[model samples]
Target: MPPHPRTTSPPRARRRLRRALACAVTISGVLLTTAGTGHADPYAAPFPAPSMTPSTLDARYATERRSIEQALRTAHGVGDTGRARTLGAFLRPGRRFLDFDPRGRGQAVEVIGDLASARRVALLVPGADTTLGSFDQRPGKPWSTPGGGARAVYTEASRITPRPGLAVVAWLGYAAPKTLSSDVLTDERAGQGAVALHRFVSGVHRVNPAARIGLLCHSYGSVVCGRAAGSATGGAAWRRVTDIALFGSPGTTAWSASALGAARVWAGRGGTDWMEDVPHVRIFGLGLGPDPVSGRFGARVFDAGPGGHSDYLAPGSPSLRNLTDIALGRPESVTRA
Candidate 1:
């Protein structure tokens, strides 16, 4: 028998093939809409009129609890301590139920502040392995505890000068992946979760019509945001979303921002984060279109300093400072410090 010819694909060709496959997977994972539909009209009536009822609120809470529990179980099975901690925060009584079905698993929006006076509203969407328990830390716990990112951002925003009448919400209202492994990258679970996220944002606007909402999406949460923002259906109300920020984001490109009609798009990635080297490729219907930090996407990229993936919101991290500045409409001077 003739000797089988040795397979000799060059390194460059192999890399190209991998990139192509990744793109295919990403595209297959996300269902793209050709036409815009659900975005709320800019001149629509103010939110929180007769539309939000007590009955609707109750139903939302019940569903959200179930979703959070499911995420916790999944994280524990995968041995993801960070995710488990986050889920623990969600299970807490008051902190987890503050927002209405933000994750689409069914939760009601808990009004923590005076909504009527708020000039700007921010919805903080967390990424992989997120759960209700990840919102705040118990006393005496390490400052490096999980789920501190969102809380830190909220606290920092609260302390900003001329805080712009802001309402910062920690929204763990999406079904995020339990780990960073690529196994779950383009699964339907995440895509369905994205759909739910879109509905939640719209629901929020329906209740708080006049608020200028900003979406702060981190890590894989950026994927959820991209999918939700591009959704023509429930995204109609998002026209009021003045700014969208992504940190340590896996995806958030000009294509997504333009599709979402966001007036401003900002991105930052920590220099030490592995995502800096992650190839920009869509896979199996997963991933956002392109990298926003590539500079070609027109996003206002910022310096996130030396911490890796989770450093964006680290205490005293430049990225977190910049985030507060953008949320408060302050200058970027703090970011340069």
Candidate 2:
């Protein structure tokens, strides 16, 4: 018998195939159990649309505040204390929201600092499981919610030298997937989020034409930013985006930073983030693709320090400082990993 031709299965290919199958099984099982049970929010209602005019921002905020107050009254009338409590927080003095909606899972775009006069703006896109009720759950704990996280970054950036007036937007403009669900594994939600995010950024530019914008994307929010970066929908507004920072990201769907169409891309992952174990492979739109921090992805790697998935924005952390630096367009100050 003729000698059998030598055969080998590449390890990298095998690993990817195994991960693909695992993803398939996970998606199938989750779909079977979760079909038609998306848990729609019962308190959904439309509110006033935002005013993008820089001169009218305060008026728009005032309009939204009044709408929120009405929503709070409605929530109280409906006996939904949880929703009422969340809406009540928005009524507090000095809480400036660019956009507010009481609809499903809710949407809020809160500004921390003066947006009207800011020379630099950081838009903080949060990850999964963020909602109105959980907006400020842990209050001063910073990392506990998107709003608190943005505040922490603002606090850190305020301390930067040659203080360039910076504004931070806690943008919960899309419905994030539940952290425990299979939805987080794919970019479906991200695709929808990109459109909303793109519009929001465009509006921001319209309001402040001179300001430089930076995206501070966290976890699944990085996926949203990646999609927005590569999206062909926006105009010169995208050109105003100076930097994009992906932290604790599973993947950006793009193969590399250059592919994201971003001017500059920075990536980091905390030393102890559990997301490190997630497979970085894309198969038939099932996975999130290459890890952003990997050399292969070609992003500027930064030191995220020894923290968990949610600790990237923790007060006084290196990751927070690096994020502030990136937002302020001071890449020279960012600590490399």
Q: What is the TM-score of each candidate against the true structure?
A: 0.65, 0.87
Q: Per-residue lDDT for 1-337 in model 1, tens only?
A: 1111223343777656655754454444334433445653222111232233333654455555665566667667767576567566667875534343223222223333434457777777767655434345535332222245545666777766535577666666555655434433553544665676666667667656777777778877777666666554534467777777877776642264466554577778776665543455565564445787875666777777766676577777778888877766554554531
Model 2 alpha-carbon miss at residue 188, Å? 1.2
| lDDT leader | 2
Error of 1 at 114 (Å): 3.7
Pairs of residues clashing in candidate 2: none
Which parts of model 2 have CA positions greater than 4 angstroms off?
Answer: 1-32, 35-44
Model 1 poorest 10 in a row by lDDT: 41-50
